[model samples]
Target chain A: MSLPLLEVDDLHVTFNTASGPVHAVDGVSFTMESGDSLGVVGESGSGKSVTARALLRLFAITDDVRIAGSVRFDGVDLLRIDERKLRDVRGGQIGMIFQDPLTSLNPLMAVGEQIAESLRLHRGMGRSEAAAEAVELLGRVGIADPERRATELPNSFSGGMRQRVMISLAIACRPRLLIADEPTTALDVTVQAEILLLLDELRRSEQMALMLITHDFGVVAATCEDVQVMYAGRLVEKASMVHLFDRANHPYTEGLLRLVPRFEDAHTGRLHPIAGQPPITGGGGSSCAFAPRCSHAFDRCRSEVPPEVAVGPQHLSACWLAAERAKDATEAGRPWKRDP
Target chain B: MSAAAARAVLEVSDAVVEFDTDGGRITAVDGVSLQLSTGETLGLVGESGCGKSTLARAILQLVPMQQGSVRLEDTDLGSLSPRELRRMRHRIQMVFQDPRGSLDPRMSVTALIGEPLRVHGIGDRASRAREVAEAMELVGLPALVADRLPSELSGGQQQRVGIARAIVTDPAVLVCDEPVSALDVSIQAQIINVLDELRDTLNLAMLFIAHDLSVVRHLSDRVAVMYLGQFVETGTASEVFTEPRHPYTQGLITSVPRADTESAARLQTARRLVLGELPSLLDPPSGCRYRTRCPYATDRCADVEPPPDLLDGHHAVRCHHHRAITAGEHQPSSKSMRG
Candidate 1:
């Protein structure tokens, strides 16, 4: 079989705080094939962004951080790569689009110069060639009057337009994989839709693997084909997009889905909010992290971590209740009932 | 109707706000009018730079208006003296979007919620504490959180405190400006539920403003869609969202990612009506503000402004091509209606 574009196995990331060591990412594993889209979804502080950063080794992991995992891309181990090689792989092979375009783009430089710099460094193109490619990239991403916009500073562009510039910069070298972390959070709904469509078109045209990190499931439902649900630094569920929406095995996923407002819902009613906050991790050798807020928690769930249970052809969930529910539904010849 | 029964909690008529910037004169709000009946919820939705927040600030008399009038139960807001306006402030309150920025950093939650009651001279120290506790409970915040600072609480908890402060004075009207936009999806649900419960118990007439069409669709009794500085469409939430008449309104609704089975295909087919960047408020386009991006734009669209066409008793849209657009006569090749 062909090798996956990216594969992360048993990844663990920890942070040292005054109180103790915070286990940010614990035993998260997933793989993305070429041209496949995977969504990493969770609330803030759930380690979704941390996991994305870990792929590129962006975080400052001093003596405080204890990273124990293997991240392999294109049959090469990323975690063990040297600094010079890692630098080459970071922007050349893998590109990342951050949450805020205003902060990501340099205020002092012209938008075209920045994209040209990326092209020159990664692709080793000459200055004049890079300038032409920069404008072409800008136009490719649907920026109007790209030649003029390329020379303009980022401050002149709106948030949506700046985001388009960021995308142009990210894809300047034509990386094999692109990681987008809440790229549209700062945009309005209409602009957000346009950006999403643009990303979808680019992904299809380039056949590049995409790892979209977002808290908004609506975004994932719109673009992603595969999804991984994270909770309190652990991967709770992994499934195909269709299966996850049709039968969300994890309780946290169900709660999240219910929380999203639907058009058909009554205008005024009590929303069913998940009670209690996510637990704070003090160390790395703990049990299941979501035990505190999970309604399906049992004695074992509190003391011992549950193993990944297969739910469908490629779907897996780390919950005792999910396995039982799946079996019950299968035996009864009925689909799993969703909680309203 | 009896005098007591007929009093509107807040009424705004022909309200217009303009700003003089370096570029030119900008009409942020133009002839926009609305009324807040007691114990009613009105949701205002639009894309960014649509002047929804400007209209909210105008009602609170925070933003100076060039023309129009605001009345709180027959008291002319524009005519009120400075002292009279200060006295009238107790009857109406506002909750801002950023809870962390809105609340005082140095103050504890107790002090923040208690400030309004103290300013209004509603009760003594002991009674004030009791009232604070009651307000906390009303917003579903635990009493123990009263001692915490805004930074110590989570986003959802901080917003509850914001609501508690707004409702502490028993104001007849509450203007929530995107109260839950900064929160998590689950936390947004909690805050929305708290607002719903508070409205029913306290009989609050709320002016809810948000950019998310889905959230507004699930929260508002009547929804108004704004474009540039004008109201493009206004109707009951169900009518406006389900059967939008204005091209801008229909475009906004179709843009939201729905959970229907056909959403994927419909998303591909829906035409993006609004294009380019929002026009600079300092020099808005003449005639129809949306004419710059409208697909069905004609020569007349740039010369004559389209008046609000009454689609139904409660529905209205301001668009010259509303009939052709809504009737599917000039429908785009890819338009599909998803749930």
Candidate 2:
């Protein structure tokens, strides 16, 4: 079989601060085939965004921060590559969009020129041709008047419009993979729908792989085909979209699924909020990180780290409960009913 | 009707607030009338520029309404002198979206919660200290948090401090503007629960403003949908959310992404694509502000605006095509209705 488009193995990112070493991303590993869409769902400080950034090596290089892992893209290890080669790979092979477009874009530069700069740098397109292509991209992203908007500064554009501009800039090179970090969080629900639709369209038409990092599962359900649930800087569960939703194995994943309020559950009375906040990452130990907040946490969970084991075909969960279930099934020589 | 009128603690009539922008006069809240009875929660839902926040500010009397009469317990705030309004401010309080931004970073938690009591000059040093500690405990904060700065607390803790400050004076009406939007999902539930419990036990009138339809539905006894500076629909939460009449309100109901598997499945099966974004408030459409993005726009919709129609004595909708639309006439495009 052909190798996967991108494979991240034992990826770890740590920040050394006055408090201690903050292990922002603690040993995350996943693989994405060509044209596949993977979602990383978690709350803030869950290390989803940090993991995505590590794929592109976007964090500032410094003595305070330690990054150790293997990120193989197109048969080449991105982590081992030089900075110059990585820069070439970033805009050409992988493009990223952020939650806030205004902060990402330069206020002084015209919207069109900002996007055109990428085309010139990556594809070496001439000035006029790049400018024309930028306008075309703006129009493709559903802008009402692309020709005029291309000349406007970032300040003149609305939030949704600015987001569209950011999308255009990202897709200017038509990269193989796109990392969208809460791309629609700042927009209205209606506007968010439109943006998601655009991203879906781009994914299909370009056969582009996507790493969608977001807190909202609804957004992920709409966009991603494969799902990975992260908590306390670790990937607790990874499975196909259908399996992950129906058979949520990890207690943390299950807690998040039930915690978020739904429109239909308007009068359902009392949301099941996960008690207490997520623990601070980077604590040295073999103990389970989520034991404090998990309802299914046991004595073993508090002292020993659970290895990710196959709960179902192609579905993996890192929880002692899953291990217990597997042990019971093997001992009984038949499948056993899981507790509710 | 008589009972509601008798129990009404806050009444706003023909409220109009205009801003003098470079683009000329923009009416943020226009001719909106509403009544808030004692211990009732009124949820105001709208998109970003629909003027929900402006209406909240107008009711708080923070900004001068160009023309309107705001009566709090039969006292017209417009007629009150500056000093008189200041004296009356203690009974009315607000909780803002950003807990940290709304609170003073320099002040300790105790000082922040006690400032309202001090300004009203209700208690002496010893009594105020007792009251401050009580308020902190009331909102589920520990006594030790009183000495910490605003920055030292988490988002949820900061919001509790905010709620404590608002209720310390025992305000008759409390206006919360997107109180939980900045918080995480679990924390959001905690804050929402606190607000709901406080409203019920304290018998306080509340105007809960939020863009999230789900949260508003949970908290509000009555709900109002605003579009381009006007109240398009208002009714009991169940009636308004379940049987939304206004097209704008319907779009909001069907657009929200839900978490429950049943609704998510239903949404996936019957998901409708919602149309365009809200137009700029600077140049609103003639007659019907929503018509620009509305799918059922007709000649009448553009020519003359339909006046508000009251149904079942409580439910109100402002749309000429609401009846036909509700009857499934001129079926909405697959684009806007999800579930």
Candidate 3:
């Protein structure tokens, strides 16, 4: 029937740094339907944020950056569209919230005015009408006494309140897609739960597709139905939330999962930390980027990159061992042993 | 004396720290007290502005306290002479949250780790350099990176340097204030392992202050839950995590996101969900600071302040309704402010 709400095909983003060309987001592909929630998990420099920003052409201003591949959102290829149309699509159809609200929100303006400005530009409301809607939006985001709080500057609000103002600004136009990049990373656990619940409620009420990019697996399990695990700017694993936790196929995914200390693991002797840091690859290579740090890596992983293989329905893992084990399990007529 | 008392390297009692801000006087550490024994980890956890950091600094005597005392192995830190205090400071050291910001970008790693020893006149220059190299190796940093600046090191390596500097003095107690919060998840695990190894090897008692519940539970022997400059609960790690008594402790535990899918629904139904942000320190709630957002709060919570009442041996809870709440006798009168 109809196409998905958002389809990303072989996305690649490279930046010309002082050292050399850095392939930050390399050949990532995914799709999302309306009301779908997808979590992108990766460590710093894994290029999770770069992929999300590339969709909105947010990197157009950077002089030494190259973004390639098709990003089709609601039938329009966002990359090929003109600057004017892209502006209309930016905050109007695809809203985004960043990690830190202090830098994202305008420091000089009143918090309400920033939201109103977006509404006036995107929704075509008059100044006064937009101002009233801004207050309402603030209240909708659970800000107390929105009328008075709206008049105050961004600095007057606490970290959590500033984030709420940012959320209000993003959803002022009721965009069809919401991209939240580490929205709760800077917030406390109590406030983070509140914010996540708020975002979940908004997504359901508006029927918007959500793409949440964060390093925390806990946040992903709590909010998303599907998830993609990234390592060294590559999509190493993609699966349903339950399936990912239950039967993660990629070594990187398994290692990352083990890194988190669970409440049940209290007094556990030591954390099973991945041995090495994520690499900063300057250019493309045939070998898998994560091979240096992966404990399960072998000669094939060091020589050539692995292709995406389906370990189960809707579960894709890019690893040679996973492919080999899948074959072995099929031959033996049994499920593959994860540890063995 | 008890075995715990005999082994304790740090003893802090009735510590009060206040600041004269433009809004008014704010009490950062309000009569907080704890004991940290050798080779033990006492996790001090709370939301931001809850005075966990202040308490850590007060223990180190970095911040001046309004009242109470901090003793380092029978020696009162507050009563020490200036020279003696400088010597006493060497027995306790701090590792800050932001490794890059805390470290000097201009200095090499060797100098950064050796500064404490140099300042304390612990050894000759050559001996200090040797100690620096050993400390770097102890934290899993390669010796080749000793000459590099903090800016050149990776986030994980920079944190290793921070840890190296803290232990270079061979401190009896190590106060890590959000040590791994700035790093990524994988890097955070590495740092935690390093800290764990160091604590065991050196027999260094650690005061691990963080907002991360899982990390605290992983490393701590005991846990103290702080809210609005006061400890709401203090108990063994297992008791605090599995059977949190205070409403604030329950709410905080519930807020943590779990990776397992089977427990997701259980976490939600068991959630206490304390609403709203931390209140202004200058004008905290009259009685229980957590009562403003606590679902089980009532008129008694506002009318009278609850002391830290000991229950079930050493598990202490600062809540008037904790006994009834644990007995299933008290009902929540108010819901969380929002979904």
Candidate 4:
């Protein structure tokens, strides 16, 4: 097989807190092909966003932070790159859109100038050419009357429009990969759909890979072709979107799926929530991180960390009881259905 | 007023809330009329700036209503004096969206829940502690957590403490304004289940307000869909979810990503969304607020406001072209569904 467009191997990120060193990202790994959309899903502080930021080297590396990993993009190891080279690759070759658009864009600059600034810096285009490109990009993202809206500040746009502007700026450099961190969190449901669609269209048209970091499974199902489920700073499950949704092997994945409210399901009794909260990560990472929250956890699960086992083609789950559950389902004549 | 057999714990008649901003006087809640019977759960679903939160606040008298009246049981909320209102406030409580911001950091869980009862002079010291313990138990928090500060607990636990504080007074009406929006999905479900169990055990009347229809659909008996400042549609949960009348309602239902759906096309086709954004509430469109985004909008829609037309005994919609829109005759060539 050809090398992945972006390959992450044995990534480990830790932060030194007063309590101890928090193992935020523990040996998390994934690979993405060109134009492939991969979703990194987890609850808050699951280390999903931190892992994304690590790809861009956003975290400070002092005596506090200890980052050891290999992140290869276009055959270049991002971890080994110097600050100057990393800066060039950060926004030019790889753009990022943050959760809050209001804070992401500069309040002092006009919305259009922000987009043009990226274009001028990265593409080395003339001022007039960059300005024209900025307006065109604004129009492309579904902003009406781009010329007038371009001159307006970020405060002038609504939450949805500001997000569109952020997306416009991110894509202005035509980066090979776009890392969007909870891009739709601040927007309403209708506006969320619109922004997702816009991103989808841009990804398809530009053939740019998208790394969407969010906790919403619905958003993951809609946009991502592959998914990685994180729990307590580790990747517990990774699979194609279809397999993850239809035949989720991991207990955590199953719990997450059941947690989301579906439109078709009638209001029965209360929702079946996973018992207990996620554990806080400390330096020591010998035991299974999810053992405290897992109902099916055994003595082995509590004492030893489970290794990632291949459940199916392109599917992996790190849980001791997944095989047992799969066997039980099969014996009960309620086998997991595979998507055609 | 008491003609209906069911006793209403809370009722708002054509309640309107307006805010005076630099732009102008914005009608946040326009002519919204609703009723929450004793022990009943009413879901208020809408987009941001649709005035759902404002309406919830108006019921608790947190925000002063510009017009109409809110009545809790036999008492008129708007006409109550300061002393009377303070006494009545214990009968109604609220849980806001942000648990961290809503809760006092310095206060312990014990103190946070016990403060309301103490303020109301409901019991002595020992009895108040017992009440606090009972409230904590009602929301499924551990007894040990009572001594912990709000900062020591997780987001879900903080919200549970918020719920405990709201219920400590044993309020007849509980108004939850986007209580779970800020929580994670797993934590959100836990909080929602806690709320559901509390309502069942206490027989409490609740106004569950949220921006997501799916969340509200699970908890509410009857759901009201608000657009701009007005309720465009209202009906029983089953009737509204399966058979939405208003175009905006249909669009909202469609916009939500369903687990059963395989493609965005199918989802988009399910609810054909109108192109433009929501018009400004200060200087809204001349006629119906939704007319600006309604696909079946006509010149009549722009000129005269559409009145709420009853589709059935329980379901109602505000649209000039409900007949054609529901019949799917005037639907655009997209994948939007017809009634």
Candidate 5:
């Protein structure tokens, strides 16, 4: 098989804080084929965003920061690439859209200038050519009257309009990969739906692989093919969208799925909130980080870290319960899966 | 006091709050009316600029309403002097959105919870100390952390402290404005569960305002869909979810992705979206505030605003074509902009 467009293997990112080394993105490994979408789903401090940011070596400048393992994109090691080369890769090969479009865009410059800046720098387009291209890109992303709207300051644009501009800039260079970190978190629900649809359309037409980093599971289900559930810093579960939902192995994943209020079904029981806060990463060593919060934790979970074992073909879960309850998933008509 | 006033712990009618800005006057909370009975939750769901927060503030008399009546139990809050208002505030407490911001950074958890009791003159120092421990235990926090500051607590813990402080006075009405929106999904459930339990134990009347309708459904006995500066729909939670009358309500509900696996699958298919420029409420539409983005908006809508008239005894909708929309007779030109 051809090499995946992006391969993240055994990635680890740690930050040195006063208390101890904050282990964010611990041993996260995943691969996305060209045009494939992978969603990194996690709660706050779960390292999803850190994993996405590390691809661009965003942590390198910060002091006492450590990042290990490999992030291969189009046969180049993103982690090892020099700043000069990485600059080319940044807008030319990979683009990023962060949450809060209000803060992401430059207030001093017109919105068009920001989009054209990327095109001019990355593709070496002339000023006029980039400006024309920027308007078309804006229109392509569903912004109305893009030609005029392009010249207006970001403050003039609505929240939804600003987000569309952010998306326009991220896709201006026609990058191979786009990392969107909660692109719609700050947007209204109606606007979020439109943005999600716009991104899906862009992904399909451009054949760009997407790394969607969001805490919202529904957004992942709508946009991604492959899903990775992060807990503490480790990838607790990784599977296709269907497998993640239908035969989720990790207790955390199941609890997460159950906790969300759904309009489609009548949720009569008290919401089953996972007991206790997410464990603060530091000072603790070698044990399952999720053990203390996990309801199914046993002596084995506390003493030794469980290795990721396959529950289904290509579906892996890093929980001791996955080994014990492998038959449970298959019994629920998920016959393709096996007990680890 | 009317007989209905006896039942409703907090009642607001024709509440209108406006702010004078450099551009013009902005009506943050339009002529809106709502009531909350003891142990009942009336969830106000809306987008950021839709005045849900402003309405909550208006109800609490935190902000003065230019034209409205806020009756807390038998007392008319607007007529009260500042001194009397301060004295009356103990009857109705507010839980703010940001736990960190609402709580004083310098105060210990003990001091934070005890402040309300001390302000209300509910108990003596020793009794207040005993009550502070009781409040901590009620919200599931250990008594040992009473001395700890708000900064030392996690997001969920801080929210629990916020909840504990709101409930410490045993206020009859609780106006929680997006209390759990800042928390994680798992932690959101824990907070929701805690509030749900507290509602039963305290028999409190709550006005829960949040943007997420799903969370509102879990907690609210009734739901009000707000847009711009006005509510377009109000009904029982099940009624609003299952058979929404207004197109804006339809679009809003359809937009949120449910956690169920089937919803994800359903989301893959083509869907209608309610999207148009949300008009500046500074110069809002002549009639319906949502008329600009509304799919079923007609010339009549521009001429006059549709009042939220009750359909059955409980369900109310402020739409010209609500009945037709629910009957599947009024087919919007853009089917996706159902709300």
Candidate 6:
């Protein structure tokens, strides 16, 4: 059988700061198959973006930061590859787009030239041919009047337009995977919906895997098929989108799902915000990181780290409750249910 | 109607704010009018460049209006002298979006929260310190963190400090301009809860301006939808959000991704998305400012500005075809609606 498109095993990313070592991503592991669309959902300091950057090894080589893990893309470990080969894998095989497009894109170069350069470098296309294809790429991404818009600088484009340009640039080489980090957070909801539609369309047409990192659950509900929730630099829950919405195994996930006020929800009274704050990372203990904030956390959760337990067919949750439920087969459904 | 009108602590009429740019004169805030009653929250929601913030500034007379009147209780701020305006500052306060950016980094939390009280010269040295500690506790901050700098606090803590500063002088009207947008989801909930509780306790007339529809729907009693510097629709939160009349308002409501499983399943099929981004405020559309991106735009929508069509003196929509659109009589231009 063919290997999964991407497999991340025991990924740990730490930074040695003035205070101590900050464990941004701790023991996170997941697998994605070809053309799979996964959403990495988390809040600030939750290590969602750090995990993505770690996959690309995008951090500058430094003594302060420590990265240890195996990231297998199509059965090959990206960490073992040399810089020359890693460069080919970065833009040619896997493409990345960040939150701010203006910073990611060149301010002085023409928008089309930016895309063309990527195409010429990665695909070895002629300059003139790449330029012609760049216009086509812009049109594919929902940019109107691609020909004229292509010659304009990044500063000339609006936020939404600049994001479209960034997408076109990333997809110029027809990369097998695309990692978009908060791609539409800065745009209006209407523009955000359009960009989401464009990304969904491109994923279908190109059959490319997508790893969309965002903090908004609604955005993930709109696009991703599978959702992975991160908290305190650890993966708390992983499940299909429908199952995650229906039966969130982890308390942290349940808290997030309940707290986020849905515009569609009928007036549900006051929001039940999760009490306490996320703990500081890099304590390096064998305890649950989310125990401090988790409402259902117990003494065991505070003392011992919970292992990934199978809660459903393809669902896994790293909570002691999940392990308890497995031990007692008679106890069905989630241990805790949200108030009606 | 009379009871509500009597309770109105802040009234704005025909508020017009303009800025001169290199391109031309841009009407950032067009002729907009709103009334915020005591203990009532009015959510001002719009995309970027819709001039929601500018309108907030106009209400406080922070920016000079081209031609308008801002009346706080019995006083008209337009006729107030510079000294008089300064004196009136304590009555109405504003909390900004970027908590870290708005707070003075050099000052301690206690000092930051106490600055407004100090500026207004309300209390003596000893009394000011006591009041500062009280405000800090009111926003759920501990007394020990009072000595810490703004940089030491988390985003949520920083925002709490900002809210504390705004309410320290016991302002009657609190204008929060996207106060929780920069925070994380969990912390955003905390800050939102704090704001809601404070509004109830203080009986403050709050204009909670934010682009987040969910948060606005949660905190607001009344909601106003702005497009290209004009109020396209205004009504009770339920009326505006559940039964949106204006096409622009409808688009904004439908654009928010439905989180429920049943509705999310229908997301791909149901397409009432807005056509394009907000048009340039420099040269806004002649008639209905939203006509450029509105799907139900007709010849009348382009030729003449649609006057406000009030429904029972509560809900108002500014669209020529709102009636037809509401009754499902008009068809959106299929070509532009999809893209």
**Local accuracy of candidate 3 as per-residue lDDT tens digits, B1-339:** 122554778899999999999999999989898998898899999999999998998888888999999999889999988889998888999999999999988999998999999899999988898899899889999988979999999999999999999999999999999999998898899999999999999988899998999999989889999988999999989889899999888888888887757434534543454766678998999888889878889999998999989976568999999999889998887575323
Evaluated with DockQ, which candidate comes out highest? 3
- Stretches of candidate 2 exceeding 4 Å from the true structure: A61-63, A323-340, B1-6, B260-274, B332-339
In angstroms, give how far residue B52 of model 5 lies from its true place.
0.8
What lDDT does candidate 6 reach at residue A33? Answer: 85
Q: Each model's TM-score?
A: 0.95, 0.94, 0.96, 0.95, 0.95, 0.96
Per-residue lDDT tens digits for candidate 4, residues A107-225, read 99999999999898899999999999999999999999999999999999999999999999999999999999999987888888888888888899999999999988788777888
Model 5, global lDDT = 0.83
Residue A248 accuracy (lDDT) in model 5: 82
Mind giving the per-residue lDDT tens digits that candidate 6 earns over B227-291? 88889999988889988898778777777876555534344433454775677877788888888
User: Could you give candidate 5's per-residue lDDT for residues A197-275 as a string of tens digits?
Assistant: 7787788899999889998888887788889998888888999987776788888787777776755654365887777
- Which should have the higher DockQ, number 2 or number 5? 5
Q: What CAPRI-style quality would you assign to candidate 2?
A: acceptable
TM-score of chain A of 2: 0.93
TM-score for chain A of every candidate model? 0.94, 0.93, 0.94, 0.94, 0.95, 0.94
Candidate 6 per-residue C-alpha lDDT over A126-215 given as tens digits, one digit per residue, 9 for 90 to 100 = 999999999999998888899999999999999989999999999988988999999999888877877787788788899999999998
lDDT of 2 at A151: 96
Two-chain complex of model 5, DockQ on C-alpha atoms against the true structure: 0.51
Is candidate 1 or 4 superior in DockQ?
4
Stretches of candidate 3 off by over 4 Å are A60-63, A324-340, B1-6, B262-272, B335-339
Report residue B5 deviation for candidate 2 (angstroms). Answer: 7.5
Tell me which of candidates 2 and 6 scores higher on lDDT: 6
Which ranges in model 1 have alpha carbons more than 4 Å from their true place?
Answer: A60-63, A264-268, A282-286, A328-340, B1-7, B331-339
Score residue B232 of candidate 4 by CA lDDT: 93
Could you say which candidate leads in lDDT?
Answer: 3
Runs off by more than 4 Å, candidate 5: A282-284, A332-340, B1-6, B260-273, B334-339
